[model samples]
Target: MIENPGILFSVLAFLCAIGPLVFIHEMGHYTAGRFFGIKADAFSIGFGREIAGWTDRLGTRWKIGWLPLGGYVKFAGDMNPAGVPDAAWLALPAAERERTFQAKPLWQRAIVVAAGPFVNLALAVLILAGFAYAYGVDRTPPVIDQVAAGTPAAAAGLAPGDRIVAIDGVAMATFSDLAKFALIRPGQAVAVTVQRDDRRQAMPLTIGTVRQRDRFGNEYRIGRLGIAGGKPVYAPVSLIEAPLAGVRATAEIVSGTVETLGQIISGRRSIDELGGPIRIAKVSGEQMSLGWPAFVWLLALLSINLGFINLLPVPLLDGGHLLFYAVEAVRRRPLEPQAQEWAFRGGLAAVLLLMLVVTFNDLGAVGVWQRLAGLIG
Candidate 1:
């Protein structure tokens, strides 16, 4: 029933985009397992039916699956369903059990599980560095690019030709600086300085409240300044500088993600804005049509996200398992079987709930909900 080329392209893009990243992520586990003297039974990319596969001398089956959503690495003597406890594994004798993930030292297991996310983070940094190196950084100068007619800026006598010299007598070096003055402190009246034909003029301006939409259909409040500023051009720098640029961008992205999460928790952000697989497909398809640069940028951003999500302290996640292992290490014993089972059930429920929420948000954003409502109307 998939007729649209855009949908098809989106599917392909999702596979192409997520497959390598997932493969690399799982590979991190596989390689770390090997390093920790654990034996991997199977390494698969994607899920469900195996489309193609080959086995290595070590008896590890490398495979491509029909469902390209995600992937996994199965280590020998591990519990079924990954990281579970197995009676057979326990019965397999100490030497064999040592190959199990739980049987290894806590530090070793943590490294193996943590490697996937770590690789993703590293890839993000590298991609960011590469991007900064290719394109010189851009910043908006304090000069107004355009002013909306009848808006606050225009009403306050701000003009397109005006160059912002300062705000409240604080010398403004760039247009972005002036913008931040408006954005972070919305609804506050502030003094503005401008250069009019070599003469400095001052005026009072107030920030306006605006609605911003996320990947999901929900909206959030942001400060709006009705003027545009031109980005100051910076020449591309040396390789060294490129990595520094990468660090700056990546740090900002991480910080933004954290801040957004905090806002959502505090009710300042809407949960309806959460995106799911459908949204990702749409984005992937759109990016593919846009060009490779945009696609690559999305990939890097998603990679960083994937890395961050995996590190959350939730059961069934890498971080969660690492946390349990840390506790086990500290206690010198594993947690009770019932406790582990309960933790897993809770984790599974949380994940399913998240999935449902995101699916609903995606459907709404894609106009499915709106179309149905229109039909009813």
Candidate 2:
């Protein structure tokens, strides 16, 4: 088991990071429902027994629960979470029927339900922009901070503080460019020009073999250098540039996700890389240990993930509900209860199965289950 302060910090970071994201998501539903004249019975963050709660004049219960996993906003007529089906409430009096969710116009219902995921997406974009504004955009500069002990640069006698003047005969400008070059050639040799000790020199170095794993069981490959570069400073941009930064960051993340998914589908990437909450928790802990900045960045990444996952077309999720709303919009009526129920059941199964697989993968990656088995043996 991981017992470092890093792990504990990560656990806290995970909660702190997700707590507000969930709240914002629920708030979206609450806001839209209120706008459409639908009363909300309760707005609660987390699940299980309530830790703190207060009732509003509107007779709504707003509470904070002990669990930090997620939250929900219950509508006045929701009855059960999925909302009472139309036929079941037909026998109720007219006044009572008015409060029921099924009685609302399909468009209104769709807006209320879809609001949660939409809020998440909006939060991601805003956060990205905020990060960019605060940190300024990181541009690639052709500088080598330090080369790995057994990396190609190390073998070629490259030392720390060597600024790469050029790569592959092309003028180098940023660390990003150097990073891209390194990533592209995992085991290939390349010519590099560096300024070391007020002198310029050219060297041919073969990228080192992949070391793959470290003492902590973490895996990373070296570029055959004994030293790497220090942090190179970049000029911060004005607030006006923040939104553009956010858009670019969001686009990059979305593009990367799409590419990764494609790679997985095409067998270029392994399914073993899929991780669940366990992996996230571990990573969160490690990042938190690194410092506040790392922790905050992790929070932003997780927020984006939460938003992305909630948009998947799985019944019981925000996306699944939206899908049903689309169907109703076209058909001019809700789908049959039997069909909806079945779809929900399938979705539930799929989600649970995915969680299980991801959990297993996470534990395996962390060597937790293996250690446990070894102890038993």
Candidate 3:
């Protein structure tokens, strides 16, 4: 048995979580480019100096780099991983230019770039489908199992057998919907409709608010009706329906992420909730300890987030490349080389800055900085 198993588990779990997703993303670019008859000069996992590499018959260099956080595909005629064209590319012979990525038709380029994020989404759907096919999902129905005394549910005359049908006229499908509805509207008044003995009745109730603390001592305010769900029911779904369920599940994650981001941006939520690599690693280990199934679910969620982030219209990302192509199509020409260079530089700076900030937050969350400060003191 290993001492400090949590540290070991976190490291391994983080790698397992990131490795497959990165490969899927980069392989998407490589596969799509080759399919379009564009030659790939190199494909690498990670950045910096190459640790190991091999060249194939097609002259594509496949390599693993020192860093393992992400990867990229270098299409022929690209100056770097950003897919910018070089002077050598522009001066190539006509036949050679044909094999280069930039020389391809606009639609093909877009497909090659968009393929990475698309594969990520597809991978998420497939992973989720597999899980659904195997064990289905555990869910709590809208029927109230317990109404805590002195809470909104008890005051509103909600009983143990009552089934919540709607909140403010919005039909709720599950117990989760009830929680979701109340959590964001702390201290607000809302009408909840319930079905009892096949008769529906609406009850106006005030959402109770409470300050909750995490193990890390971070505080948050949330609303509650103070009702608990009964035992979770696991529905065994067929394979055919699994993929459809996967689609729905993936969409829910995306929508929830977008909503959270919107809340943070609108100042309705705190930015402190944003996490980085360390937080992910910690969560990965915690999930792995739960079960392999839970770990797989974490990977699926991470895959979806990877796809979403890469699709942002910021330079140095797949979405940024697509943005450039869109502008080219509209303006009937590519942006000036200098302009493109400066844009990529700015994007790199922005990405690096974000990484630094997130890393700092992670350090703070894990008490690394505080511990060091104590030592110094």
Candidate 4:
């Protein structure tokens, strides 16, 4: 049992991190379905054979699956966990059909499909709000305190006393803002507006790129502006203001994520940076070791990512379902069954391919290939 605490912690930490998030995500769908008078056949966490569960008063079979990867709430008419409509169920009488998800109006179906991801996003915002209320918010100004030699800031003619006013005309209110803006735009040129001698001057600067490794040896390729900010100052956030602060913080995270994806798509960033379950488990365990605060913070960040990813327009994902619903709304009818079948098949393939790529990346990051090579040698 004591053979490897790290592996044990990683497994446990992964469960702890993923379990509730999945529960909440499925719960969102369940609650929304119930609100529309739709029946849920089952609520299962993870994906395979049942581990344990109980039937609810509403007749929903609440179960835990052996696979701890993800969970789903099966509605009355769902063919499977992916929420495909059962053709036989759809052929039922009108009175029976009223209680099924597909029988609902287009708008209601859209809301039901969207509720899960929105709930995840809302959960993240609340988590951030709690942190802001507890520890306050950073109010540090974006004034340059240092410019490292042989760096972008040095090349851009930035000086220590210069006060950063904006980047490409977007006002930089805080040092955090500046950092967030730069972090997602590595190797991109931007106009930096700085206030010097009571005058503002905009100068073109190319962001630098750097590869860094964490304590756990996970690699990251991020932007570096090569300038340091003045000492930070944090102001206490009141209860009323905390939610707004949380929203702003959440927006920054969303913006950064979007920018990073854009960079990856544009070939400005490496696809190797994508991570999967293994990397998440490793990081989750490391954060758990640090303390609850760190772990909880990771939870919030992951929650946001989960919400964002599910919104992508790919079949088998929440976003894909929404996309289909959108087409139904526009065409005034659902897509043909054959078309949907093929779309879902394609979506499944895409999702599986992505999982394979990220898993390969995770293995490489953990040096699994190196260890195997060493053994072979």
Candidate 1's residue-wise lDDT over 1-377, tens digit each? 22233667888888778888898789888989999888898999988999999999988999989877678898887665436576776688887777777677778888999999998888898898998888876555678888987677987899887998887777777676676556544565878888988798788888677877744233556666689876566667689898887877787688668867876787756788678888888777777766788889999988988888888988977888878888888998878877887897898899889999999998986789999999999
Top lDDT prediction, candidate number = 4
Candidate 4: global Cα-lDDT? 0.89
Clash pairs (backbone) in predicted model 1: 139-231, 139-232, 140-231, 141-175, 142-175
Tell me the TM-score of each prediction against the true structure: 0.80, 0.74, 0.86, 0.95
TM-score of 4: 0.95
Worst 10 residues of 4 by lDDT: 1-10
**Which stretch of 10 consecutive residues in model 3 shows the poorest summed lDDT?**
1-10
Candidate 3 lands at a TM-score of 0.86
lDDT per residue, candidate 2, 353-372, as tens digits?
98888888888978889899
User: Which stretches of candidate 2 lie above 4 Å from their native place?
Assistant: 1-7, 80-84, 91-96, 139-217, 220-235
Which is the winner by TM-score between candidate 2 and candidate 4?
A: 4
What tens digits encode model 3's per-residue C-alpha lDDT throughout 203-302? 9999999889754344567889999998877789898999997887898778778877787788866666677888888777777876788798899999
Q: Clash number for model 2?
A: 29
Q: For residues 1-377, write the lDDT of model 4, one tens digit per residue.
A: 22233978998999999999999999999999999999999999999999899998989999999989899888888865445457687688888778988778889888988999899999999999999999999999898999999999999999998999999998999998888888777788999999998898999999998888766666677788999988889999999999998889888899889988887788877888889999899888888888889899999999999899999999999999999988888998888777888899999999999999999988987789989999999
1 or 4, which is superior by TM-score?
4
Q: Lowest-lDDT window of 10 residues in candidate 2?
A: 220-229
- What's the CA error at residue 69 for candidate 2, in Å? 2.3
Question: Which segments of model 4 are wrong by more than 4 Å?
Answer: 1-5, 80-87
Error of 4 at 94 (Å): 3.8
